[model samples]
Target: MVKQPAPDTTRRSEKSRRAIYDAALALVGEVGYPKTTIEGIAARAGVGKQTIYRWWSSKAEVLMEAFLDLGEQSAREAGQESYAFPDTGDLAADLKAVLRATVDELRDPRFEVPSRALAAEGVVNEQLGRELVAKLLEPSLQLYVDRLRTAQDTGEVRQDIDPRIALELFVSPLAQRWLQHTGPIDHTYTDTLVDYALYGLAPR
Candidate 1:
């Protein structure tokens, strides 16, 4: 029978995990995903290969979790929960606030480069793409779903609207802009998106 690691041992392991995440993000940003190896990450992180292998199966898995952790840290620094949505009673206000934060995050170098590497890889790698969408992207999107549902209940959103599709009207546009360099993302742009999506651009 194998005994669990001691508390100090666990703390040290966590420290190593953080170091590995930092190393993975940095290496991916500098070298891109194709050249990023578990061995390279371990060497840069000052840990053994077995340590990383014990925690994660592959470089892709390590980088995926690393990016997720990085996003969560950035969100926390921005005074927002990584997995929760802000509901300020006013739909437009809440969406604009959240999207403004997203714009800031997209511009952050620490978040931007690594995310680009991962997103680029996802576009070409089908399995990793699905895994990333399911594990990392969908969970974040569900927060929007929950918020939109609440807005519908309170009459701030149309009752017949599909929260998933409706939320994407604003969300996916920003994502596309950031991913493809399609346009500038800013507070004003996102604010306008909320207005257009909610009030309709045809006449109202």
Candidate 2:
């Protein structure tokens, strides 16, 4: 069998990984995605370049993982068990809670700065946009899809409605408001979106 790293070595590796993540987030926020480089990350992280190479092959990979880790960190700070969406029986309440958490996250300076920079880059770079969508956005969107499917099964939603499309009814509005600065983003706003999307603007 191959030899494994010692316990202390594992701890050190973890420390280095955290440092790298922090450095990558900070640099991307400060300089934007195009200007951020692995060498800069290594320098800020106080690790050798080879250390980062051993873990990630490209700056995009490093930045992607860093953002993912930041999201997990935010979830832990919010006392969540993991990044998974809430699954309370009350679908509206669950969606509202998650959206409120999202509002908080969007308002956070650490998340907002780098996220804006990366999002701007994605608008111009089709390849990067696709990669980011696949790695980051799609997974989160799937949670909403899954919840909507459950609602359909239970008759909370119309049987013929598409879960994926139904999810966009609430989610897309919030995303557009946040990304475009067209309007405010808060619990009340998202609650309204959920209500309108589920119940419809016209009277039943």
TM-score of each: 0.92, 0.93
Regions of candidate 2 where Cα sits further than 4 Å from its true position = 1-9
Please report, as a residue range, the 10-residue window in candidate 1 with the lowest summed lDDT.
Answer: 1-10
1-204 in candidate 2: lDDT tens per residue?
A: 112335557878989999999999899999999999999999999999998887788888888888988998888888886568777778889888888888889999999998988898999999999999988899998888888888888778899898888888888898899899999888899999889998998889
Evaluate model 2: give its lDDT. Answer: 0.87
lDDT of 1 by residue, 1-204 (tens): 112335667777889989999999999888887899999999999999998887788898888888878888987887767766787898888889888888998899988998899889889989989988987889888888999999989998888999999988899899999999999899999998899999988984
Give per-model CA RMSD: 2.9, 3.2
